[model samples]
Structures are given as C-alpha cells and as structure tokens.
Target: MKNITILLILLTLTFSNVSAQKIKDGETVSLNGLSVTFNITNKESVTVGGKNFDRYKVSANLVNNSEKSFNIRLNASPQVASNTNLVELDCINATGAKLTSKKMELKLKAHNLNATYWYYNKEGKYVSGVLPVIAGYYLDPGDSVNNNAIFIVPQGETPDVLLRKI
Candidate 1:
C-alpha cells in the first residue's frame, strides 16, 4: 500500500497541468492587457522623522499591451507560498493598522497618469509613487514600469510570492 501511494503521488504530480507550475523568480506572467515580472529583494530599512521601518519588498515590472490607455482589471494581490502550503499575510495600513484582507488589488483608470500608487520604496516607507504594482496608476500602451509592492511579513520568515491562475 505504501509503494502504491507513493507511485500515485508521483503520477499525480507528473500529470498536473503546466499552468499549475509555480512561477519562479524572474519569470513573467502575462494576462489580459498586462504583463508582470517578479523579483523579491531584501528590505532596506530607512528612518523618517526618527521612525524606522523595514519590509519584504517584491518588485514587479508591469507592461501594458494595449494600443491605448489601459485600466487595471486583474486582481493583482500576491500570495506568499512555500513548497507545501501557500500563506496569506495580513494586510496592514500605513499607520500600522491591521486589515481584514490578505490580498491587494490594483485599480488604475484609463489615461490617468501621474496618479499616486501604493508603492513601498526601498527606504521601507509606505508612500505613493508610480512604481507600484498593486494600486491605481496609469500605464500608457507599450510602456513598462518597474513597480514595487511591499508586504508586512513577519521577521525570520522567508516568503515566496506566488501567482497562480485558476
């Protein structure tokens, strides 16, 4: 029975769809009218007005594939996943308040450039900028921007952001 179970597990893993495979670092996922490439980087903490902050940052390169201005229609919330399980980290506000959501979404309007998006700079502060993947920011067609999305993951836990399509 043990040997049969092991063989079954192997067969299941081998027969899984290619789309179920995890998107590794430096890989790009394209959907709808946008494409995203991900890379996780160490948090570079910075102090502002005597308060220090650090975060686990994931930088994503976003490309617009439409001929005109594009509005964000995809759910851009990222998940931290491991080999065995996928973890959902708590969503925190700028004032350090915990929220009920574990997912983040982006809602950019068409032709709206210079809009402040939710970007956590390398300095570790939650500020609005053009370099944000999970917020409202306009991207002209054929244009790409390296957006920074930071998470408030706990210390000592190395997290892998996973993008899975259902």
Candidate 2:
C-alpha cells in the first residue's frame, strides 16, 4: 500500500510538472534567483463534514536555478485568503437558505505525518520540504520543491480572493 501511494503521488507530480511547463505568462515568478512556477490544476467544490467547501488544488514548484542556497519564506498573504487558517465555507444550503451552524471552532492536528509532496535536496534526491510551524522554507542550489496545497473555500458570497495562481 505504501508503494502504491508513493507511485500515485509520483504520477501526480509528474503530470503536474508537465502542465507547469506550458504556462503562457505570469505563472512563473522569480524571487532573487529562484524560479517558482505556480499552477492551479483543479478547481471545484466538495462536501466535508456536511459543509460545502470550494476546493482548489495548487502546485507550487520552486526551482533554485541559481548557484547559491537561499532560505525561502512562503508567507501567507492577505491577498490570498485561501492560505489563511480560517477558511469561510458557503453559508447557504442547496435550497438557498443560510445554514445556522453553531458557534464552534475546530483545530486539526497531525503527528509524525509523512511528507506527501515532492522536493529535491542539495544531492538532487527527492525529499520533502522542511515543515515549519509557519509558512516558508529553504532552497539549495539545483533543488526543486513542489509545494502542493488544497484550499477549501466556503460557498456563498464568493470570497474576497480566489486562488488566482496554481
């Protein structure tokens, strides 16, 4: 099962990278000397825990095309509401009436979780990015990091910001 899962993930990354290479314009952004490609391969909605949520699957590929090692920070920007801790889901149900959910907060927790995405170390081997308590990480020369994130957006009055980049 572990091997199958790894194979599936590798396939996903391979396909995503192929799509990333077809960007026409601003999808590729440069920071210092690193070339980061952001691609949104899928966008839709899903029902989780009886609530409607918009889903955005994004793949952020960071390539240290330069010769130096650099510490990179993936800052959660206000302009990108998808990266926030509290994602507002759609308040209305199928019939259009608003849902009166109780006032409750939920926190997600994980322990010793294996890395799911793809990254390359200084030795060029596939690995995972250093998981920080916050956003951001480091990149070494010839290293490539594929950072994938799924944004669960609430349905209703559309959010102030959508997942504009992949």
Global CA lDDT computed for model 2: 0.45
Per-model TM-score versus the true fold: 0.37, 0.35
Write candidate 1's Cα lDDT for 71-164 as tens digits.
Answer: 4433344432112111112233322313212332333433323445787789899887664343333557887765455654444443345554
Poorly placed runs, candidate 1 (over 4 Å): 1-22, 43-55, 68-138, 152-157, 164-166
lDDT string, candidate 2, 37-112, tens digits:
5565676767777987655554556566778865444454322222321111221222222342311111111112
The RMSD of every model to the true structure, in order and in angstroms, is 15.7, 21.2
Model 1 lDDT-worst window of ten: 80-89
